[model samples]
Target: MSDTITLLYAQSVIWLVVFGLCAVIALMFRRVRAFYRRIAPLGALAPTAATIAHLPTTFLRSFSGSEVTAGGSREDGRPQLLVFVSGSCPVSRKMVPIVDDFARRERLSLLYCGDESDEAQKRTIATLGLSESGFVNDAAIGRLLGVDRVPFAVLLDPTGTVQARGLVNNLEHLESLLGVQETGYRSLQGFMTANPRALTG
Candidate 1:
């Protein structure tokens, strides 16, 4: 009878250990899922209704007669970086310095397009220390680029292909657009989805 009880107790202990191990495994999975969700780069604002990626963009000249080509042969042979901003948008104002620094550092062909009047566009250009030649007063370019939000950016490759485009609220967000292009992902979320192991590693 003692031997029987010992055997039963050992079996019970084994079962308990099995259940505990299962619970631990489940907890680990939950933690991993949470980690992925935390590290996944997602934007608060959605993209414009029109899809801009991989599409040819149209060009319009700035108010100062400087050629603003979005997707075409570049005279300078440098990639173009088009940014949409408004005079009334505080976010756009905040991004001016950041954009200016990026433009100078990257040597990108930068164009600041907006729906604001020519005066307002000029004022913004002056405030940002960007040349008037780089400021476009037309809203049509923004519409064609699917930029419904202020402080939006679209990076075009040298061959005039849309490399990346998105609403940018900060420098990190702006860099993520370039990251999307480098990774060949439509967005940061797409990158994370395809490479979940990246986060864990």
Candidate 2:
């Protein structure tokens, strides 16, 4: 009868809506998987294989006009996190705030260094809204740590000993660098290799 037809039509409409929602979810999942796969390769390039060595003592000046001694013990009594960046690098520019946030969260004295020209450096400082402190424009700082790449990071203990150094392209890479302090491994890959339990645990 007419009543039965009405009920069947309503059911058909409900099933169509459910199918549409499912299809949308599946499409979104595929996009997420594709994005993850693209970034996975970039993450694999981090935590360089070269042995990290102690940095030589060097004197530098901060953007805030403070005399800073880098790569050596300081009276501050805190670990140092050195981030080697370039004014011209898009990745470095995009990471300024992120690096600052990470450093603050980790309670590490952070220093930003680059070899770009004075103009470019100033532009980065202004564009990134970096407070006129904790930024070093000296090229020597990077050279002292044998940092031949931009967007590199080095974590040094309070005594100025290098704990970890790596090329960081994402937050995950930065987290793994800090993990070195606990696992005594240069990279998470090394840690997983030495401790298979890392995979499950």
Candidate 3:
């Protein structure tokens, strides 16, 4: 009887250990699931207020009467970067030098889009030290590009597909568009969410 009780007690202990291990495993799974939920990819990059990505953009002509296509066939086959700005906007003025440098470094076909008067636009171009050839005088172009704010930027692929578009007030914001293009992520948030391990590991 004592042996029987000992055997039963040992069985009970084994079962208890098994249950405890199962509970521990379950808790670990729950924690892992919670972590994944916290880092889940977001759709914030696909904002309703902005133009959709991967869509062909409309073409526009520069003030110089040269065809400045955004997302269509061009003889150069180079990617285009369009920056919408206003001559009177202080933020736009501040970004001019940065945009100019970026364009030169990236070898992108840069175009400055603004609704300012011809003289004001010319002055802004000269002050910014950008090529007059890169200035497109059409406010309607902004509407077509779905730009609602000044200092907005759009990066188009060689095929004229909108690769990235956002409000760029500083160098980081502008560079993030290139990051999105190269990483195949829509936004910085999307990148962090998809690669949570990159942050922790």
Candidate 4:
């Protein structure tokens, strides 16, 4: 009788451990499935150049006053070009001159949104001649724009939909989205890099 009881106890302990391990594995599988589901939307999207030309309407709210640029003018119109920069990002510096020139020429409506309290940021904007451009203080615009990193630019229609987006560090991705034949645009790589950031929390 004593031997039987010990065997029963040992069996119970073994079963419990097995069950716990199964539960942990199941939980991990569920988390991975959820991550895949979020990004699946992008996979289903056929990122053709023609489809990319039309700007999609953005779902975020617009800024109303001095807090943002063009009196929130960029927000009210169709998807316009939006760029995000940080006071410390070197890549942003490389693109600022291009952005300022693009905006000044009115080739596209550009909005430069960045961290507000840094005095150097003010100087950076002034130096770039974007002081009167549609400057916004909102970080959400960047997130909403699906920007996961700095030195990024997006061509938005007046509706706020992202027509095209990429590292514009070379403007190749930008040109591709616009359907222009640029010598060095890598649309695939840009989309691949930005897709992960767009779907993740």
Better of 1 and 4 by TM-score: 1
Q: Write the residue-wise lDDT of candidate 4 on 35-144 in tens digits.
A: 78876232112232323333344333222244333212354453356776765776777777766666555467667776455466666566555554356555555555
Model 4 residue 128 lDDT score: 51
2 in model 1: Cα distance from truth in Å? 53
Q: Of models 2 and 3, which has the larger TM-score?
A: 2
Q: Model 1, range 43-103, lDDT digits (tens) per residue?
A: 4233664354543646667777866566776778887888888767788889988988887
Question: Each prediction's Cα lDDT score?
Answer: 0.74, 0.75, 0.74, 0.56
Please give each candidate's TM-score: 0.67, 0.67, 0.62, 0.47
C-alpha lDDT (0 to 100) for residue 188 of candidate 2:
55
In candidate 1, residue 176 scores what lDDT?
71
Ten-residue stretch with the least lDDT total in model 3: 40-49
Q: Which parts of model 4 have CA positions greater than 4 angstroms off? A: 1-79, 103-106, 115-120, 123-129, 180-201
Q: Candidate 1, which segments miss by more than 4 Å at Cα? A: 1-38, 43-46, 51-59, 119-123, 126-130, 189-201
Please report how far candidate 4 places residue 151 from its true position, in Å: 0.9
lDDT of 1: 0.74
Query: Lowest summed lDDT over 10 consecutive residues: which window, candidate 2?
Result: 39-48
Off by over 4 Å in 2: 1-52, 188-201
Better of 3 and 4 by TM-score: 3
In candidate 4, position 136 carries an lDDT of: 58
lDDT score for candidate 4 against the true structure = 0.56
